[model samples]
Target: MVYVNNVGQAIMQVDRWTTLAPGQARNSVRIESYAVFNKGLFILDVEAAPWGCGVWPAWWTVGPNWPWGGEIDILEGVHDNVHNAMTFHTQPGCSLPTPNPKTSLGPNSTGWIESTDCNAFANSNSGCQTVDTSQASYGTQFNVLKGGVFAMMWADDGIRIWFFHRAAIPEDLQENAPQPNNWGTPVAFLHNTLCPTSKIFYDHQMIFDITFCGDWAGTSYISSGCPGTCSQRVMTPSNFANASWTINSLQVYRSPQISGASLALPRPRSLMYLSAGLILLLLYI
Candidate 1:
């Protein structure tokens, strides 16, 4: 079920995330209960507004240790008309080789630059690829003008992602409903491995949030002409102006047939009745 936290503003925000100052790292947000991620699948579905130049907004995941555990950046970028980068931050030992198909914009369009020189994974390195916005700019692409769905799925083997034009998101998964079969396996992996710590992999609470300007989207690209104050180039006053990213909701689901139990269960009361009858028979005998 989807739970909306109505505390801060009528606007949507998950209680699981702590809002930080503009310069805070994405890893800095503390989570109180991530235990729910044990063995099931987690999905994040967001509908966002477009922000202007230098304003970076993202929906990502990170683990305890820096690169040892891993990090998954599902959706991240600055300008509305630019790109939506999907990246993996892993330990030196683990090689995150981009498949032969490498980068793809839509199913037909493909091409992306891979960088191992700069540490995009570390606070020092920032790596990304731009998605063409000629068809529909980020602002118009997501808002009421013409929005779309950006999804990430997490599972055991690997990670995969797919972007759907507003018209494409299947009707069932549209409003944050947990529709596993329709999501497919590859997509599920990308969403799950965002921050793959063996213990916390599938058992942590996933979060969806928006910050004005933080380290990666805000500062890392400042030298490349991120517009803002010279001292803190990532922070742009115009960022909060016409900028906003909206999430209709987020939903999670476990495999339908994981432990041999039927996916279709009638009701809790029915199960209770069967247990009560078994208890009475045992006592009588």
Candidate 2:
């Protein structure tokens, strides 16, 4: 179910208080943006993200036509993960550099390249993933810090993702003028000579989902050391007490060279709740 909290944060959550029958999927929320973006800056200020076993949550963007239009996973995790994985899902011929240069990581970034291939068909749809090594980057620890900001830049050069702790968010970002270049090295950088951004990614819409015991989460359920099987856990409603998203705001800014929308105006209301969590307050700038 979805609603605004007493603090005015947009909340999308699972049916944690309801018990379900076998083979039944938990009721949740999945909302997408009405407006599509070609290349722009996306900022998500999160107060809390879903956690716990059998839970898979993501704040991402994807184009039409599946793999061809490409997918960028800015914030995604499954189960009891302590770190975040930034990924790109696309067709073959898209890849990041192996033995990535040290400069790829900003001085403050605590992440590393996990895979170079962007092929969704390869390695079981692993895609090209850069993983944040910091324990606070995801899950339980992230909630302890009360969440923070995730800024992504999708541009001609490539895509870059940066995470800042609540206490360390950049002043310019908080002031409404985000200068990504000055923000230093991103935790994950998807640029490479082999992958042309223009060919791989196109008009895409933002997506936020909180799924239970799906492919990504179920496949790794046992390995995560969570008690019982994924399906069994799904029947236990209380297991998802923490499986919800409390969002402060979501804002998008087009490049100065490409102008269309004004700065910080609410987009048209077109919320699609299929199966997971969504951001209720989204602004276009």
Candidate 3:
């Protein structure tokens, strides 16, 4: 889960997400998979943004079983979510196409597409979502304009997400060499001909979490009005003190057409289940 707090000399991989203070039944902090990807380009420069009223933060990508090694939530929403959806759970022969679901956008997309069957439970689970027209991009107005830039461009031939706000991020990803074709429009897009993005995606890993009531803030807490459940406002501790998640930097840029890993290929994690948050890049071109 990549959390080397007080290591001595050189390990350096800290996410420092905190929680478990306020009340007590809900706890927080979750960093799954240090780094693991089968594609390329995954960036996150969140400085701070996880609003209150029973928060349920997330950053996703999955593999290791469950839905046949596929699941990408990107950045979820909960509580008083003002925007930011981007989902994709899978298993049943992959799917897409809803409210203009196509790929390779770069003209500064606003983002739409509610759900178009990314399987997981077929329609009811409502995977395959995409909605982020920048209502500050999500929560507390995206931490008041201080946090932005989340780009994920996995490639077999499709999967793109771009959101740059902290002064319009793009300049080769602030000089880190992340081109992403000029970083224009792509609030979300999924292609690879609908399925077979390497047999429904694989080897994902990379997740940041802040759990609370559970299953999406106790099943949506009556759409954030707060009636009951969600374990009673997570055991009520001043309603989570504005939640947490304040990451400042993260970068994974690989894909000069594949490098040292030689072509990250491997399957059969016995039937994986811990799944996606996508961060294990070595995808050479």
Predicted structure with the largest TM-score when compared to the true one: 2
State the lDDT of candidate 3 residue by residue for 140-211, as single tens digits. 878787778798877766677778888988776676566565655578777766767677888998777766
Alpha-carbon RMSD of each model: 10.9, 5.4, 17.4
**Residue 46 error, candidate 3, Å:** 8.0
Alpha carbon lDDT at 255, candidate 2: 48
TM for candidate 2 is 0.88
Range of the 10 consecutive residues with the lowest summed lDDT in candidate 3: 7-16
Over the stretch 70-181, how does candidate 2's per-residue lDDT look in tens digits?
9999999999898999999998889876744754442334477778899999999999888887788899989889999998877777787889989999888787666665
lDDT of 1: 0.41
Stretches of model 1 off by over 4 angstroms after superposition: 1-40, 98-123, 127-140, 144-146, 175-205, 212-214, 219-239, 256-285
Stretches of model 2 off by over 4 angstroms after superposition: 100-110, 256-285
Which is the leading candidate under lDDT?
2
Q: lDDT ranking from best to worst?
A: 2, 3, 1
